[model samples]
Structures are given as C-alpha cells and as structure tokens.
Target chain A: MPSLLILMPLAGIMILNFAFGRTMKRSAFWFAVVLFLIQIILAIFHHPVFWSNELEMVDRFFNVSFSMDYISFIALLSIGIVSLVSLLVARCSIDNEEDRFNFINLLVIASIGMSGIVMVKDVFSLYVFLEITAAASFILIAFWRKRRALEGAFKYILLSAIATIMMLTAIALLIVLAGDPSFSVIKSALGRSSSSFMVTLAVGIFICGLFIKGGLVPFHGWLPDAYSSAPAPVAILLAGIVTKVVGIYTIMRVMISLFGFSASMGRVFMFIGALSILVGAFAALGQRDFKRMLAYSSISQIGYILLGFGTGTTIGILGAVFHFFNHAIFKSLLFVNSAAVEDSVGTTDMDKMGGLASRMPITGATSVIALLSACGIPPLAGFWSKLIIILALWKSGHVAYTLIAVFASVLTLAYLLSMQRRTFFGKLADGLEDIKEAHTRIRVASIILAAITVLVGVFFPLMFDNFILPVKDILLR
Target chain B: MNELYWRIFLNFSFFIIMLFIAGFYCILVTRNLIRVMIGLELLIKAVTLFLVVACYVSGQAALGQALIITLIVMEVVMIAVLAGVVLSIYRHNNSLDARRLRELKG
Candidate 1:
C-alpha cells in the first residue's frame, strides 16, 4: 500500500504517454488530476505499522524500506499539496497541448521520487530517488525547448552532475567505512569510531553537494537562470519543494540524525545561512524580473530555515520545519501569482507592469498577501516561523546571526514592497490597458494557496501543537 | 609483499586524483559544449575507478560491482539527455560555444 504512492504515478505516466499519446492530450490533464487526488488521499490515510525507530518494508523483494517519523510525514504531506497546486497551475498556464501532457506526466513522476526521498532510510536508495527527481526536473526545466530554456537546463545538469559525483564519492567512502549503506548502520559505526580524516572528507563532500542543490551562496549559479526560464508552475515546484527535499531535508537528516550535531557543525551552518540571507536579499533588490526576484527571495527565505536548523536546538529545528512548510505555501502562492500576472500581461518584468490591481483584482490581492507573508509581516504565517527562528538563534547565543536574520526580514519587506509598487500600485502602464484577470483556474489555485497561508497564520497555536511539536520531538530525539 | 602492494595502491589512487583534477580543469577552461561534456565523462571515469579501488581494498567487490553497474546506467541516461540538449543548442545557435548561448543574463 505504501508502495502504491510511487507505482500509481508511474502507471499514470505510462498511460498518459504511451496509451493516450498526442491524440488524447487533453485526457492527460484529467488523468494527472485524478492521480494527484488519489495520492493525496493515500497520504492522508497512510498508517504504517512501524513508527520512528523501526523501518517498514516498502518493497520486500528489493529489500527497500522506509521509516515513518514526524519529519517524513510533514515532508510527505507538503509534497502532495504542493505538487497538486503546481499541476493545477500548470494546466491553466501552459497552452501547448503536447507540452502540457508531457509536463503533467513528468511532474507526477517527480512527485513519486520526492516522496521516496522523504521516506527512504538508506543512503543508496536516497541517492537513486534524488537522481530520479533531478532527471525529471532537467526535462521539465527545458520543457519549452527554447534556446534559453535549453541553456538553463544544460547548466543545471552540468552542475548537478558534479554534485552527483561528489555525492557518490561520499557514499562510497561511507560504505567502505561502515560496510553498509543504511543510515542506522553508518550512524552506529561512526559513533563508535573517532572522527577520522576520511570520514570528515566524505561528510564535507556530501554537504557541499547538498549546498549546491539547495542554492546556498557560492554554489547558486544555476538557481536564478533555471527558475527564471522554467515555466511558472515548474518554478513554483522547484523553489517550493524540490530543492527542499533534495537538499535541505537531506542535510538536516544527515547532520542531526545520522551524524549527531556538533557545535562546530552548527557554527558552519550559521555562517553559511547568514551569508545566503544577506547575499540573496541584496541581489533581489536589483532584479527587474518578478520571477527572478522571487527566486532570489526563495534563497533568502531558505536561509532562515537553514539558520533555524543550524542552531541545533529543539526550538530551532521546530522553527526550521515549520518555516519549511510556511515557505512552501507562501512561495508557491507568489509564483502562481507571478504566472497569472505573466499570463495576463505577457511579461514578468516589473517595469513592464503597473496598476494591475484595478484590472486583475484577484491576482493583485493574492500577490500582496503572498508578498506580505513572505516578508514576515505580522499576523501572517511567515512572521511566526521567522519569529521562532530568531528566538531560537538568540537563545542559542548566536546573537550576530539573529540580528542579521531580523535585518534581512526588513530588507525582504523593502524589496517586495518596492516590487508591489512597481507592478501593481502606480499608474496603469500604457500597453496593459486591455489586460484582464488571469483565467479562472490560475485564480483558483492562487486563492487556495493564499487561503492556506492565512489560515495557517490565524491558527498558529493549533498548527504548533498538532503539527510542529511532534516533528520537533522526533528531530531532538 | 604487503608493503609493496600498499605502495602500488597509493600510486594508483594518486594517479586517479590527478585525472579528476585534469577533468575538472577541462570543464572550467573549455568554452565548447562537447569538450565540457568530455570533461564530465572523465570525472565520472575517475570516480568509477576510485570506487572499484576502494571496494577491492575493503574486500567488498560484489557490492561495489553492483553499485558501479547502477552508477553506469544512471550516467548513461544523464549523458544521453545532455547530448540531446547539446544537439538542440547547436541547431538553434549554429555553434557549440557556451559563450554564444547567452540569451539569459542578469
């Protein structure tokens, strides 16, 4: 039954691609919707017999297994919701019939890989799933097959290839040391031995690979280009969840659970997190393209999550996990809003847009809501998570990082508000007079995401008690 | 005899590292897309050699062989897709130079 989450999508892809083909391209969209609904339902009712400490067999024949902890559950839930939203947004935004069909199929496949990443207990299986997601994303990023899109895809693959090689090296080293690739075995082995130079080298290489995937400073060359060129729905998926699962989640899992968090590791994470925050915010300040700015903003927001986990405290981990969920909602909303604006006005450049609020009221309102939430405005989901992160940093005695995080939120507000002013508040641009609200589908998706942000914000205590506290407990254990 | 084997293993590992560095240098310096891909292939080869060596040293040849097979399959798929992208780029731009494919910039 647990395996169905992955197999169902593979079946959907086969039926859509080979069985239906181009003759029934429209059916692909409906097929994807059905598959997503089924997956979501399965996720909601997914009750594994084993809990955090025990591994349950996902595929007995292959000896593959997964564990269900609170962290994996949150990851599973977010991947389901975010993928569904992105699929809906894609259906509305993409006009090419063939492209739409292929896009939906690839997305479903990628979601399977993502869920696998969250659930898998062994490093080798994790690598396989991560590559699956990476392969799907490479094609999705270049779905349009334009020159720039291809260029972005090529650059992404090149960088990712290097990261993969580094990761493989690390895996080899770990396997050689522990004589097995399972996380539990590796943990016990490492715990018994003093930190050797070879182990340190392997860990360093592994973290470096993850840093590239997560788009941290000094390894973020592929991010802006890929995000800007990808269709808005793909952009939303990549920024909102893909990077988090492949990069951030793995980092947190390995550092905290497998390796055991150390003070020196925490300090390294704090420094990198702080650096990404400053760099991403400052770079975003100069961007004219709305999606590109949002892309940089994603980097800055991701920095906060990293900073939270970097503190290595229970509260910090809770804040990081909560912020991870919150960032997915608000960032997906913002990207969907960007898709709408681009679809209606035919440009993502903020300079090419103005006073769209009067014409596209829903988009304007949703974009404002998303931006506010992203900026950590009071009474929004972003604020509570950022507050928790800041509090965690301060309590952890990283006063300098806490100060920078607070200042970065102010910078986030400055840039996002300026973006709002340029795109929606001032006089209507001359050429965009006939612009109208986005299609009903796009509007609906954005509204759903925006509603989540607001609802989560308004019910913060309920969210903390019911959802976050359990995940915090698991991380700290 | 064991000491002699150790010396040989160290020399081989050092040689693989040199190959890895050379491939990395090729990727960084080359403007041609094909050359960059060649560099990537070189790095993969080096890594594969290193993996086999590690497995041989650790007496886990069977497990290492299985991993290498999987790695090779994945590597093939990646290279195939990358080649397709390169073909498209060449068709669109009429050149294989990375410098020419610059429509997207900050």
Candidate 2:
C-alpha cells in the first residue's frame, strides 16, 4: 500500500507527460500533489507491508526488487515533500506556459527516479534509475535554453558521462572478481578474497565515481554552475534531493551494505568529507552572488553529513541522518528564498541590494529564518544537527575532525549572515522601492519550510529516536 | 605448459592497451569538438575490445561481447546526432575550441 502510494504517482506522471491534452499541466500538478498527500498519509500512519521478505519482480531479463526499511521509508517521504514544495514554487516562479509543463513533468520524472534509487535492491536497477534521474535533470537544466543554461547543461552531461563510465568500469571489474552483481555476493567476496590489490582497485574506482557525483571537493566543479544557472525551483529539487540520493546515499549503501564499512574505508571518507567541509566553506565566503554562495554552503553542509556517516559508528550514522534532513529543509528554503528575491528585485547579486525587508516582508522574514537555520543557530534545525554531528565526532574520538566540523559550521553561518545583511537589512537599494513580495504560493511553501526547520529543531529527540536511530542501527550493523 | 597460448594472450593485451591509450590521448588533447567526439568513439571501441578480451580470458560466453557490440552501434548513432548539434554550435559561434566557449560561469 505504501509502495503503491509512492510508485503510482511516478507512473501517473510519466503517462501524463506524453499525453497531449489541454488540461495536462494542471492535472499533472494536482496529480503530483495527490501523490505527495498520499505519501504523507502513509508516512504518518505507518502502514506495514504484508510480506516480511524482499519483493522481487522479474520482467523480461531484468529483476526489479524492493526492500523497505526505515531509511528508505524516510527518504521516500522527504522526496515526496520536497517535490511538492518545488511544484508549488514552480507554479509561482515560472511565467511562460510551455515551460511550466516541461518543468513540472521533468520534476515528476526526477522524483520517481530518486524514489526508485532508494527502493531498488539491485545495483544495476539503481544504475538504471540513476540514469533516468540524470537524464531528466540534464533536460531540466537546459530547459531555459539560454546561453549559460546550455553551457551548464552541457558540462553536466559531460561530467555525468565520465562518472557513469567510471562506475560501469568498476562494476565490470567487480563482476570479474566476484562473478556476481548482487550486493551480498560482492560484500562476501571482498571479505574472503585474498587479492587485496583487486579489492582496493575496485573500491577506489567506485569511490571516485561516487565522489564525482556527490560533488566532494575537487570533483565538485560542475555543481555551482549547474545550481546557479538552472531555474530556482529545479535548483531546489537538485540541491535538495538529487545530490543526496544519487551521490551521498550511494556512498552510504556501498560502504555499509556492500563493503562492510571497513575502518580503512571510513578513514578515506573522513578525509574526503573534511576536505569538502573546509574547501566548500572557505570558497563560499568569497562569493558575491546569492545563489552561488548558497551552492557553496550546501557543499559544506553535505560535507558535515558525509563526515558523520563516515565515522562508521552508530552515533555518527545518526548524526549524518539528522544533518541530511536539516540540510534538505534549510537548503531548499534558501533556494526558494533566492527565487523570491530574484522574482521581486530582478537580481541575485547581493551587492546590488542594500535592503529588501521593507519591500518584501514575508520573503524577508522567511529568508532570515532560513538563513539562521542554515547557520546552525540554536533553536533551529541546523544547530541541533550540527551539535549531534560534533558530539558524534567527539564521541568517536576524532578530535581533529570534530574541530574542523565546528569550524565549518561557523564559516557557514558567517557567509549566510553576510548574505542576509547585504540583501535584507539597511536602506532600500536604488530604484527598488516598488518591488513586490513573492506570489502567494511561494510564500506559503517558504513559510511551511521555515516552520518545519524550527519544529524539527525543537523535536530533535523524537526525530533521532524514531527515524534516525533505527537507520543508524541498520547501517552500523 | 602452453607457451603458444601465453604468447597469444600477451600480444592481444598489448595491442588492446595501445589502442586504448591512443584513443584516450586523443580525447585528452584534441581541440576540435568533432575530433574529441571521434576520440570518444575510439575509446568506446577500445574498451569493448578489452571487455571482449576479458570475457575470453574468463571463459564466458559470447553474450557479453554481443551486447557490447550492439551498444557500440547505438553509441555511433548517438554520437552522430550529437555531432550535428555540436556542428551547429560551432557554426553559430564560429569556433570549435571548447576552452573558448565559456559564456556560463558562477
């Protein structure tokens, strides 16, 4: 029942995309909303699947299987919520008629692909879904067809192609060494195999591929351009869910499910996560553009989550999950606020605006909330998640990493405050007194997200105990 | 004790490696987008050859090889379409150097 609640909307959206009709656009948006509401009901009520074991369906030569646990279930809910918010944001931001349809349809397909990635048990199945998501994202990025949009889309395609090839080659090597593509088979093979060289090579290649997709440090060249140039609604989905599911989630699955979370692998993840944290934070401090600074800050926040998960301890895993949820909410809120700023004032350059709070009150207040949330202020979601991660790092006795994590959080706040001060405070900018606030739908979505950010912070214990703790146990085991 | 088989395997691996390296070099150094596309095609071909060799070494059936060959054909068609698109871009901008095409940045 729960799976259907998630999968049916995906199927409906795919059909709606190609069906030529006058009412397709409105129908698709409402259909997507219906899907999200159903997912919400399922999440709140907690329906249990009848079958205790894994469910597999054999279609032609492919085996598509799904196994549900707390992590995937939470992931499904997050994707649903974010997709709905993005839809609402899009409905407000997009002006053209044709673009509205394409944007919403691509979003539906991308959400389906993301959900499929979380649900699928097979590596090849995951690859197929990832391809769907990546392809949809490529089209969406180039949806604008402006010169910058085209270049960003092209670079995204090229880099994604490179990463996919690396991953495929690594999968081929694993098949050669393990003789099977199943996660369980590969995991056991890596454990029992005497050829350390082959195992190391395979792991190295796979990690490289994952990191490129994950946008960690040096492999993050394509991220800022893609995030900054794409439409803000699409950017919300991309920055919020796409990177988390395809990149970070894959790393977690590979490490915990396929590689047994080895100490050496943990060390490697920690190093990369630390590098991403410092590099992303320091890079963000220098950005003058609102969206680009947010993009860099996201990279830094993702680093925190990755660092927590890399510790290979239960506390660490819990921190990582918390950080993931926090980052998603605040980042999407920030992106939407950026969209609102762009809509009202017609610019994303922070230097051009001295003050906007007087002109766009709702946008101003919500942007402030999101900025504080992102900066990890106490009583906001980001703060608790950041605290949990630092505690986890300290508990794991990684003193150096813990310090770096705290430093990165401070840096995140500093840049976010700078952006806020430039855009929301002081006198109104020249020729901007008449700029209006965002449309109704946009304000509603941002307000809901800001409220969630605060609610999640206050209810951290419930979040950790119910959702994150179970997932941590599963990953650490 | 099969010296002939050893000689054949080593010669095959050497040829495959050379093909792959040449294709990779072209992809890395080529300035023209069309030449780079050709290089990518060559690289795929070389990888297919290597995959076929691995299958032979592992005593697998011809299914993997057959699948790869079909993929190569599909890749060729896709590349042809992409080449047309790239050609249009080049004609519109009057250049083929990828480095010069930086109208997009943060």
Summarize candidate 2's per-residue lDDT along A1-477 as a digit string, tens digits: 334543576668767866867677667768778877776556544556532333343222233456666777667767877888888999878877677877877887788788788776655556667777887887777666665665666667667756765666566566556656578787888888877886888789888988888788889998888888788888888898898888898888777787778888888888999999999899898998888888888888889888988888887877787778778888999898998998888888899997898888888898888888777888888888788888988998999999998887788778888888899889998988788888899999999898989888888788767777778557645
The sequence of per-residue lDDT tens digits that candidate 2 reaches over residues B1-106 is 1466446546776886687688778878987777777777676666566556544544454645554665465455445545554655565577888886586564
Going through the candidates in order, their DockQ values are 0.68, 0.30
Q: Considering just chain B, what TM-score does every model have?
A: 0.90, 0.75
Candidate 1 Cα misplacement greater than 4 A, ranges? A20-26, A41-58, B1-9
Provide the TM-score for each candidate, comma-separated: 0.95, 0.91
Candidate 2 wrong stretches, greater than 4 Å: A1-10, A17-20, A43-46, A50-63, B1-20, B43-94, B104-106
True interface contacts reproduced, per candidate:
0.52, 0.13
Q: Residue A59's C-alpha lDDT in candidate 1?
A: 62
Top of the candidates by DockQ: 1
The digit string of per-residue lDDT tens for model 1 on A111-131 reads 989988887778877888988
A1, model 1: CA deviation in Å?
4.2
